[model samples]
Target chain A: MQGATVATYDFIFNGLGLREWCGESVRSGPMTMADLLARGAAPAEPQTGFDWGALWSLPFPSLDELHKACAEIPRSRDLTRSLEAGFLNVRESLRFVLDPMTQPLSWALENALHVAVNTPWWLMLMALLVVVWLAGRSAALVGLVAAVMGFLLFVDHYVFAMQTLSIIFVCAFLCVVMGVPVGIAMSRSNRFQRLMIPVLDMLQTLPTFVYLIPLIFLFSVTEPKLYGIAIILYAIVPVIRLTDLGIRLVDKEVIEAAEAFGMTRHQKLIRVQIPLALPNIMAGVNQTIMMSLAMVVIASLVSAPGLGVLVLRGIRNLELGVGLMAGLGIVLLAVILDRVTKAALARVNAAASVARH
Target chain B: MMDRQVSIAIRHLYKIFGANPVRALEHVRAGTGKDALMAQHRHVLGLRDINIDMRAGDITVVMGLSGSGKSTLIRHVNRLIEPTAGEILVNGENILEFGETRLRELRRKQMSMVFQHFALLPHRTVLDNIGLARSVRGERRADFERDALHWLARVGLGGQEGQYPHQLSGGMQQRVGIARALTSNAPIMLMDEAFSALDPLIRTDMQDLLLELQTELQKTIIFISHDLDEALKLADHLVILKDGSVVQQGEPQEILLKPNDPYIVDFISDINRARVLRVRSVMDRAPETIPQVAGTVDVDATLESVIALSGGDTALSYAVRNRDTTVGYLNMQSLVRALVPTQAPRHGNRKQEKAQPAASGPAA
Candidate 1:
């Protein structure tokens, strides 16, 4: 094993079947069929190789290495194939059980979206404007939102934007609903935190498209749930991390003080801890909503009708105006959501400080 | 105020703070010292075989330095910390065996504790924090608000009921803590360094106010303090601890006159002895022939007052009165002896609870 080096080609330049192709230049990149979708077609290779001096040589002197490789053969395909199979098994059996439990959320989101899209554009605009005005308590911010909505309407992207928005609102709502309790459980128990941290890490760092890929295989793209679950998994991380942090950050003295008063665990949590942690939780919700909007655009790849579909269509068809206009609509929605939530957060902070007083 | 009788008895209590304290306790029980337990066995001896009988309607102050387990002992009374081995009997029923529900019931209905930091719920208004015990017992806010308001007024924070804790100054915050405890109307009150967080002047005022309230309400109070001056002024029965063991405990005046431990001697060395010494500490039992008194001096009168009255006359003697009748006779020489801590450890002869004995002072 000490003098293990072999031919020059085998050591430094193995795994390349050809010397080079097109303008490849030996810099590895996306070379799949999807790359052809972005570009018109794969450029033809004009190279005829007379450079086979080092190309055909191969190393074949390692039985132990071959055995080690053979042992991993079953797990080699898909890299994490066993994990994939395990998750798929759970999804198949668990989906039916979960759908009943999660039906209310799906029902609520579906009804909400139905109302948001089916209502007259003017009435929807008025409702949103009123809500924004109430939250921000600033007529100027409301007017800015109205003007953005007005511009979106003139551009005829209002309905698509609204569709995108409704999806985000629902996903963000569900993220908070589920995330807060999980975060609380994490903060309350070290064992729960140890269990959740890796899963949360996967949810955060695993490719966003990978989340949709599994759902696509498990459920048809036609079912809203496929994208719904994908969006939730993609967007739920911030709220969970922040909510856990918020609870964990509460002053220890305050907790001891509460316990001393003979407040039961539930009473202490509700009456003391949560109110103090509200601002942090609100910030978490804000990040969740923003992330939800981001995922909504990506989710359109799987039959989720929204401004994201338009963005995808523009990408597919090379229509710059179409893509830019839809992207602009997403930006406007983001601004509105961000401002309203932030204003509400500031108000919560004020009230919290007052209570602290 | 009602005359105090024995209410809470903490007997053979041991608190060892460590994982596997039950196992480490064998070493502790087999004559291991606190240092040996910590350095050799990796266990902190929080309290060791502590015994104290807290009298009803009296301020039984427990004093110790930091890490002396004074706080630990006080917390044990409320069962905030489960003792490794011990008995805490509140009204003669062992609390060590209490289930969670019974313990909570004891906490909410029988005893209320005031904390060093006041322990006011920052989220609650003054009224709400004051009504916490009642609220814990499932009483509606309306049902307790009147009592809460009454205590608020009593503590001189009447109109501040609507205000939050942070709106008040530190002194005001502790007043609310007092009101919260008193409003609970629990028979026993435990105060752990309740005024230690206050400034010295505010501390004196707070102590005075506590004594004033105790005179009327006479609730059994178990107070924990590190300050010798505070203990001497406020304690009816003072228990001194060192390294989780009782060094000496009895009446503060008697303990001051005759410190049993060298540690206790060093502790009281810096105290203003004349200000703390009272006539009851120095006086002998009244002679069968009542003395020709210089004048009637209350048993509770500080030696400073006697010194001022007699103008350093060594020949004078006075009959020491408890309420209106003579129970003991005070001499100037005895007063001087009482002012100084004795060098020799007095063995098995200390009895200060006998002063107001045999005849109950005119019934309240």
Candidate 2:
């Protein structure tokens, strides 16, 4: 049966003129009586060599190789592989340009992680409560954060939670530092705004996993900045978009008033546009924090030390309790960050409302 | 008033609004009408050949219906809106030639504007809003704040300095706007429908306040308004606009007594003539000898006031006096005739609506 199959494939490949293109030695396998009979009967009917008869059985010899009659086209799998190879070819130059520019980010992430882990637990807890209080100024919020941190410490997951938070803090801060000016530039120039929209859309809609592939090639798996870059790329879109919208939404008559008063362009931007856009920028910051926290778990695949690493270990060892505990820790951390940022945003909204009223 | 030197002289100034304003301007200069130019070249004729010599220390009111470009003409004085072609000479220097810095200096030191909508900054305190012009010039806060506070008190908004604009009523907000203009210490005040957004009672109060301020400051003021009543009440020199072109311009009383164009006749036909016409406009110039008169009336007295003095007796005549010296005679017949407006042409409403300016206009 194996010999008969090989002979049939040889006949089809030869009939379609693709025998040499397929790169296979013709009929090298051992032959059986069925193969020998097929070969012997092949030249008996010379006029019927193309098989016009026998419609039900072997009506056409080259049916499997019909498209190969002209030329062999690259398949979908080949197209994807070649694209990756092409990207690899330019990786050296890209790394040369990007490595120096982004070196500081890796240092920042490493040092921030080291600090978060080495700090005394009591001091860290106190500092966390202080930050929450300053942002929210509400007793309820401060108590909530204190309770969640206490629970994490009780469960011995405090270090992992802090690692995740440290990563988020560094990445989200950088996002705001870079995103706001871009948003301002977008708001001020129509041409710049038109150019930036598609880029923002691509960043927003791209699958979360797809970007990680290129990022892995760009930096070492062990470097914290590999995930830092990943988190920043994933989280910067909202702040930029919201800031642009906020500035553009200022009342037209107010701008006219500013111009009528003979305000210089810089003076107007600082005194009028930025202040009015603050509430929106705050909201963007809130969104960026939430997004960065979500990205930290995915970032753990590249050896990021966090609660995500615990979850990955549980999955590998099939330890159900460990996985569940780490997952709960992440959820608690997310709630803590979300509430803190939201409370700050609410305060800004209140101040802005007072101005409007 | 006649001897006062011209503060802002707009000569052959034209503003066409479109992508190709300069090309459209050639058609306008060749006598193509506003509507025709719009239809043929898709350009709006904002102002056409506007020529006015605004005297220092006098209120020059540019009156027009909506779309008549009174606001456009006023903006040219400050170079807020660039003209397609023309020269605006402020104090004998062509302001059109001023570059960005010089133009800003002109707006900061020589011209200040009050808007129809009180465009006070919502985020700023009333005091900061009042000091906007000085603040933009990088003046020390302490230096401008004192002047801002003084004007604040003068405009009747004292002790409201700490409140944001949204915390105040519309009338009060506009008072802040007026004070802000005053704080700039600019010699030329441009009021672009400054009181049109207020209630009728508030509008009247604002008008009175502006006139009171004008009497004290004697600034070269260019006031734009659609209301004929406001124009006649405030204008020392009135320019009536029709379809982006001036139809008649002179003393408000003269424009009322001798309307040079049919459009002006139609415009003034609906006005309360008794309230606007003055005895000086209707009275005969000083004669060699005075005729017998029932009583004397001031040259500036409204014709309605003279009617009350004469008891509606057409046979009675009054001596027109200027500070107790007889200047002319006002017969009751001529006063009565002046009170009766000239009949407007029957088919003028369509043209009136088409000429309505986009900013706003008072009801006829």
Candidate 3:
């Protein structure tokens, strides 16, 4: 309190009357040895030693730290606390609007997890191979998927790997389903794209922990949607951004040709823009899958089930073997997904360029 | 073969590209120049007071350098780019007042366009691209396949129909574009620099193909180009633009013989005039008594062929025949004189020049 001083910023903010929200009151006097001794009646030993080597120190609470300890100016921490409070104040309203809208997402994640875990390992492997074949049309990629699944099975991490994958599958699918139309809407309108870019930039650049803090307050930890929502929010950005970019980047001459041929906006979008943009969209999907895997592991901090759970347990119990094995399992799963999607992307690229020749 | 009339008539068409086009239109109407309008008001005057009557069953070529707004003018006929102010009449109907549904109907059923870049859809096969306008109208492939294939064969792309656009050379791709336009069966075809992207030999071939098609189809085609030779070859009526305004427009031969602007003089300066000027243009109409002639040449024969016919003899004269009917007499001397470019009248000398212009004409 004795160190409190009214700086110019404090005077300005005090004139603005922001003290009630964040400011502390100023004390009556500055500190001195005489005042300390008079108040406590303690005897002091005087040392008349002077240090000549002293450099000129800055005044207390220099301009750089003016807002740190001022009475009238709001501190950085207080400003952030108020921001959190403002968001919390609307939490009930936000939940009321978002809960029923998002309850299906929880069910989708839960059912997918349940179905994946209960399916016989061989059947799941067969189905995964079929999906891989369908996406890639490459026998080598299909065999790669089979080998990765076999390795995970042999390591006894099959169930945990399935859990992580099932969650990723549901989330990434939902991201594409929801993100593409939003990206289309953005590409069609300049104002919408302008409005969405900052939002997308913030979603991409914000720390994973910052958003998780609010989600934890908004939903119960036990809710499957807590992590599903987290994974979706973190992974959906690339797909949306790339979809918009892809559509916008279609050849202007082609677009003009479409218009000159009297194509309706919808007809042009469906028949021309989307077909041409498919390769870029597929690349976005690949990035989204990779991002979903990354976010799922981080989401394990909030009780998201998967190999991440084993990794968490290993960390808590200090079992290096458990941690390393789970880590290897996640890495293998990531490689499988990455290679499969990349193979599919290559197929799309080839088809697109085949005609370009 | 068919009655020719005005197909697309653009009147006082003005297009200013900027945030406030209406305000800029005021400056344009006040006769503010294109560059000045840009410098003073930050608005691009894309087109200014363009009035041209594109005739039915004839190719009206709009020729200009890039940014002279020839492209902009063509787009306006299709309403691809809207005008800041104007009237566009197709078959005497003002298209500028048409609603979106009516405009779409007009575009879908009455007009189709060819592009400079041969903008065939890369994803679609050549046949599919040819059938695009019909497909956009929700027509089944079976419904248009016969007609589309007919045009495909007509454009000499029959076997290549299954190939993509990129598989075709630039000339071949534009042939596909032409086939697509023909398959639409629209009477009005807008070609925006259609043959400009082809090689010289291919361009000549395309020009011949277009002429051959025009003789058969007789559609009202509006062609845009920057090349004077192509314009002379293809244009039934030539409209030349400069700085977003029409410098002069008329029969190509008439414009060549009587260029009204210095800009046009410069544009036609380097042209091989002997190849483009015609016997009919430099001939005297219905002489009282037929003069001694080296030969009779077709009314449409180029002066170059006529020169070769007379062996460059200045004393030789030829009778001009229009389909076996003697229409005029072309003196080789006047033909040689017509080969010389017309002098562009400079400022303050126009009135004096106009008083003496009867001597400079090709009429003997």
Candidate 4:
């Protein structure tokens, strides 16, 4: 690691004369090879190039091969530096737009997380039971939620799990609120749909960890929006897609009949399209919620406090029992949320079918 | 009387379906045929220069086969399909020039359509379905429910208000459709193959009910049908269409008797004339000191009833009465001549068999 840092500075300032070509570097201090290596938290170098103690020493794990590869890489007209500047500029420009849009989400998440951690354990548990019972209208679902939450409490993960739930609830609600109208707009116009589908595809196909990286650069880690934005972007795809599909799949004759009856555009959308699209929309909401929960765990790496933070700590300290208990708590929370939402979806379908009959 | 008070008038209406309708409209105006237009330019000519004056308080039935654009023509009245070029006037006001608000008002308050598939919303109750137009007009449930219930009962669906469309049979659903159309009280009702989807028996019953309702309501009805018999029965004015152009148009009886186009002639060739031709159509001026007949047939009675009353006596003469007044006289000779269809090629043999049935069986 020491040799690599010395070579990097030597190539940049002396061997390449980069100081004369590109001006002095923006770095403030006169960083030495040892200081740079220490700051990077790099691994210690192997004393021997051939470690006969290891099974696969032929596959050298030093930067020698990487240095040779870098030498071969063309630097005649480098684009990487300019590209990085461009990306930063873009991120700066988008801040004005994204900050306002994401503020409500930040507020909801902070307040909910605060309340969840501050409230008494019994109070929060009772509140969760009431909410589950109201949504599902089922005693069994209530009992199941109570049991799962009770176990989390017993394992000393109750507040952490609650914080995760609070984030998920806020993210999922915002996703539905924002996604449904976008979907409706897509359903109304084919051109709009064509424009939006590619963007949605990119969002959904992006790796989950990649979602946090750009967000981390774009917003401060201390700001609630850093993780809030990541969770929303990761989870909003299903709701928008299903909503557009549901509205598009409405029967043509039904639409024609609506038009013939002199229904206005808004009336038709509300009374005919949305009512018929309830089942698909509800399913989308369920998927969005599950995706949000999944993202919440991953989002904790960027300062989000939850059971995921405990899991991260366990991993850092190599504590097997702590990791297992946190993982179990997350699983239980997942089941409770899934069952409650599924029950609500079933009720919606029942009401729709009854209306149809 | 309604002939003088035209309710809806379609003038020079042309509907050409394709990317470039103007180019196709030029071909249609140049007297291009349907097949030629399609083959040459990949355009479908839906209607060509259609001109029909739908009278107030009368049923004008437009009859044609599939792809003849009868449905297209009826829909054009409501501007459901924008015409390639033309004008539709409702009550002397051009509907083609109507803006969105006016168009919506026309659809909501002036014209209500009955679709062949009933078009009842599957998600709504029967009463709600009937009140759709009213509801779209922003009427409250209480304001329109009574009218819906009234029409529901009138269509013999009184006790089934709370039922959904899927729970009803095809015929019953159409009755709900009729109730829906009437509940709006739209003066011009456009029925596009309204009874075509029902069983024959239920269709006949619906036709009878429509005729019964027409007697009192006197709503101007523009009924589109592919059945010649249904057209002849229902239409006060019949328009025959073929390949998107009008082949003939007149009173149903006149069209049946003096079909100008061979296509019109062939279309009515298989019609059972005796069932459709009324006594007033066959009756002559009543002669003074008319002989007391076996029975006085009403002027509105069908020729089949007259044949039954005569008891197959071809020589018998009957007094045709309009209520208590003797309006005209019907002799079996004229009835026989009317029965000998002008379109049939072998007139002698066919007339002989028809006379044989007319001779012995009718009177009971």
Candidate 5:
């Protein structure tokens, strides 16, 4: 029975049924012997024993059954094709965001927002000092900040730098505040970790320019919060990823020891697990800050201020002096931020040690 | 003599890891055993039907190879791994019923454990690490440090307070671990193969230190080791486990004299029984009078020590005194008989023949 079914299937697949539907005229629909002579097709071999009745009267599936049987094949194939297309679309969108092809609207929006914020020169200098203070408490950091502020003042780009600093501070703070809990939640639940990991990976690898495209569609350049939102989206991924990693990497034995000591889950988390995991979390925070700084420069393309304007100015008019000084100021700010947060992390870990003792 | 003095009592405890622990445990209780349970669910019976008692001021050594559930057994005492079925009574109180706070309090005040690997907090100084248990109990820093320093000195780690665990030798690290446990002042100390990771020389030193400490503190101790020699040396009572079941449990001398089963006999076969055995094994009644001697050996000294003092003299004799009274004499014949090389039969027989003649006469 299986063999008979296979024969019918082969017949249908080879278009033998189409020939039958065309009717028995034309010598039973193109015999191998006649076709070989007429059209030089392959020569036919003689059959020793032919079961013509068995061949013709075999039970075969109806057209509806065939359609039903083969239906899932195309459906699965289409699903695979669509999935590939979706992945391509995602990749393309990310590429577009990272480095957009269209420059004029981006440039115009950047300039309009910059003019509207128009932060005062003194406020910008103060913001720079605050950035320096928050990042590092060292005299070296303070001195570096003072010198950069003085140079910014000397160059008359103080207002732009402060506008940039304010946006970065707010965005980075929001990222840490929001990302850490989400990361913790992700670490706690396997289902949540599985679901969030891919999304975080996509966010991390997505092009920065692609992020602006969605925001550009959602909010106009005139809004003060536009750059703020953009900066947060671009920089939030590092902290989320790092926080998840940190909590997951906490030693199982330590946690078990804490539990053995009769610590409540919350108490263990607060007193033992998190304290032990703090170094990694702080390292994550440091990465988040660095990433925020990196995005601040790109945020400048959208009218977010700071050293980015000097860079933009350098690019547009080929003014090397303005760009070089601003670049130096940004580096100084980055160093100050990196050092201060790291020092704070070190202090926290030290305090945790003291408490553990 | 009070049964109520039993510090920890574990009865038929079962720990099976799976979503269906009861079913797994029931399977075990029903004689399906570990293999059947593992077939249904990829679960292991880490501990199975474990019944034991750790008494006050006695060190019960749980001797087993790796995966025989020695560590698991110790962990269950503190409820680190909750037993599936059975009661764990610590000081007449079933700890299975202890809530988080009470359990924490029990761990803080009643029990302290030392791991084989010496699980010292890596980032903290020796002083801070030793003081951690006190701080966890909410003691003030100065008081905790003072106590930590005292305990550190007790463990022979004085003046090493400022150093980190990494700076210490393996033996010193374990000493710090002991000090940390001591600083907690917990009545029961669970030492899980505490000296198993140290060198032989260091291990012997640490064992001696533990014996000295135990003499003074009289802390209830549950020590785990796979080494029979170690168990024989330190344990007043010995519990041998195999495949998560108790093979034997008795006083060390009792186990050595007559092991309950061949498994235990094989386990302790390599042990130097004569060295580990007591004076009761080879004692002889005193003659009417024993000759006075300048030096006297303790009755508890091993035959090896007796041989060392006899100086290869076939006719040597010693005066054995208990306090002021001369209890007896130990003849060189007995000492030679005990210490003669067991492997060389000809030499052993020659020594035995030579010593028999000396035994017929008393010393001047």
Candidate 6:
């Protein structure tokens, strides 16, 4: 069968078989098999030749030679080892620095004290006045504030609203102070961005209850700062992420233009980049404040004083009236904060536009 | 050099990006050079051995396609990206060597830039956006506002100061950008395709505005654009870059008339030569005493304008005069020959896209 196959292959290669077949046909002139093949005749041997020696001896440098070529280079292994060492050192130093004894006395003291100053009840009334002013004209603002204040006064929940307001202020402030720089840093460096983004993603996706778990272990449950810190962490991610995103989103052309004008890196960041990124950052801040409000109520589980506590109190005691009033107060606070920040953002955008002109 | 004379001088700038930057820089310095450096770091050469001198009152347009290092080149002028090996002189002083305070001062006093996307602070009004640089430079709010208004008025955005950028049209936004740059009162302005983002019509209008502003202020502008037309229109001196190196640099007219490289010739292929070339450029000078005709076109007039004048037989034979003397006459034959597309030598004859012939109708 192999000899037949080789013979058929030779016949196809030389075109003798086709020519012989054609010669026997009547009323047809003798034609070469090459011509027949050229005219689309089938081939006998599709696989004609192979070089076994060339295939067996594919040229390659020796392993030692390759090693010599690669030596004295910055090896990936060395890089990996150094990186690991650096990270280990950083972690160790962080642990040492963050040791309980080494921590600032003031921070420890503040953490130890379970007391947080709740805003006076008058502040809630003040907030209502501002909210009224923003949502409506002066008369509407006054009327709304009066109605809310009168309702709270009648219900005797004014003090609880004030307490919620104060805690929200402290938590929101800390969120801003910490979140903005973290956002800026993330915006500035790709490595930092890569490192922080996953952390941020984890923070964002983790259940709000999960935050209390870590805090519960780190500090006493009765500490006021515990809830404050928890609320800040819970709400801070949005601002930080947004700040980074906003700054990154600032038109690259604009940054280039700023640099072309000979603006220093710092000047450009502070003057050009940050200002442009502010709207999104503020939006982030707005979202954070909203989130903080959402968490404030949950934080009431750990004695965070606010309308949250009142609502919790209402739920625990099954006081439908108390819960309803407290919920209403929280809504009022949320609206007030939202409106004010938005108004402030509007004002900022307007001023920036005007200055641009 | 006098204080006001020298604008910027860049000398032998090099930048190498790597984990071991110092080693890469040293290797570059040792003259195994750009190739070796790139080999070592697997880095793309952003700007290689760049040397440029920008003068006061001139618009030097850096024309290059994206990633040609035009942006990187401009960034180096301000020390935004530090050069690996180079010196940049601003007013004869090496600005790259300047400390932070001096650099900031130089930027605050001597330069301003307009971005392509009209980087108006979205959180601020037009007034505040223009006033930001002033505020950053520590100007009083009231003083800055007044100055900003003046700039707004200059850019024809006098009454729109209170509106947010979102409320304005793209053209108006760019005008605000121009105004923002102007508000700083810096002598040097860098515009990186500042009008590139706008629609074509608005871009033209903005270009006209820039020209008008240049006429008034002449602020040693360095504009970057990928569009050759924009570069030709606005630039006194044009630098055409390809592959992180300058392909050619010359006056726009020179580059247009006699392109130094095939790349530039290809770039300028579609330009209406009749429109771009002036009558003075192609016209042969005649004797001063030659008799002149009653109707003569200006030497500065483009061939397109001259062609439009050729309607009937009488209009066909118009005089091309230099000042008062009739230097030459532009007939239909010469005009047609000039208008006929010339094939570039390197790229074989490009068959022009033929206009579909209009079909005749029995009635109008």
Question: In order, what fnat does every candidate score?
Answer: 0.41, 0.41, 0.59, 0.45, 0.21, 0.50
Q: What's the TM for chain B in candidate 3?
A: 0.93
Each prediction's TM-score versus the true structure: 0.82, 0.85, 0.88, 0.81, 0.69, 0.65
Evaluate all candidate structures by whole-model CA lDDT and list the values in order. 0.81, 0.84, 0.86, 0.83, 0.72, 0.70
Kindly report the docking quality category of candidate 6.
incorrect
Q: Candidate 1, A140: how far from true, in Å?
A: 5.5
**Model 4: how far residue B31 lies from native, Å:** 2.4
- Residue A155 shift from truth in candidate 2, angstroms: 4.3
- Model 6 TM-score? 0.65
Instruction: Summing lDDT over every window of 10 consecutive residues in candidate 4 chain A, give the lowest-scoring window.
Output: A68-77
**Residue A344, candidate 5: C-alpha displacement in angstroms:** 6.5
Off by over 4 Å in 5: A1-159, A209-223, A260-267, A309-357, B1-4, B30-41, B162-164, B261-263, B281-299, B312-364
Top candidate by lDDT: 3
Candidate 5, residues B267-355, lDDT tens digits: the string is 56556755776543344555666654536766667666666677766576776656776566777677556443333343444455357
Clashes of each: 2, 4, 0, 1, 6, 32
Deviation in Å, model 2, residue B18 alpha carbon: 2.6
Give the worst 10-residue stretch by lDDT in candidate 1 chain B: B355-364
Q: Which candidate is the best by DockQ?
A: 3
lDDT for each residue of candidate 6 in A63-178, tens digit (9 for 90 to 100): 32222222222334456668767766676555455445323422532442223234444664676577656644446447645776677667776666666766776678778988
In angstroms, the error of model 2 at B159 is: 1.1
Ranking by DockQ: 3, 2, 1, 4, 6, 5
| Tens-digit per-residue lDDT, A1-357, candidate 4 | 433433322343345654454343323334446345566786545567755654443334233322322333323223555666777889977888888888877888899999988999888889989998888999999999988888888877888999999999889999999999999999999999999999999999999898887787788899888999889998999999999999998776677778887889999998889987888899999999999988888888999889889888889999988888888888888898899999998887765534331
B105 in model 5: Cα distance from truth in Å? 1.8
Clashing pairs in 1: A357-B166, A357-B167
Better of 4 and 6 by DockQ: 4
Instruction: Give candidate 3's TM-score.
Output: 0.88
How far does residue A319 in candidate 3 sit from its true spot (Å)?
2.5
DockQ of 6: 0.21
Residue B206 local lDDT, model 1 = 94
Runs with alpha carbons beyond 4 Å of true place in candidate 3: A1-89, A353-357, B1-3, B344-364
Listed per candidate, the RMSD to the true structure in angstroms reads 9.7, 6.5, 6.0, 9.7, 12.2, 21.0
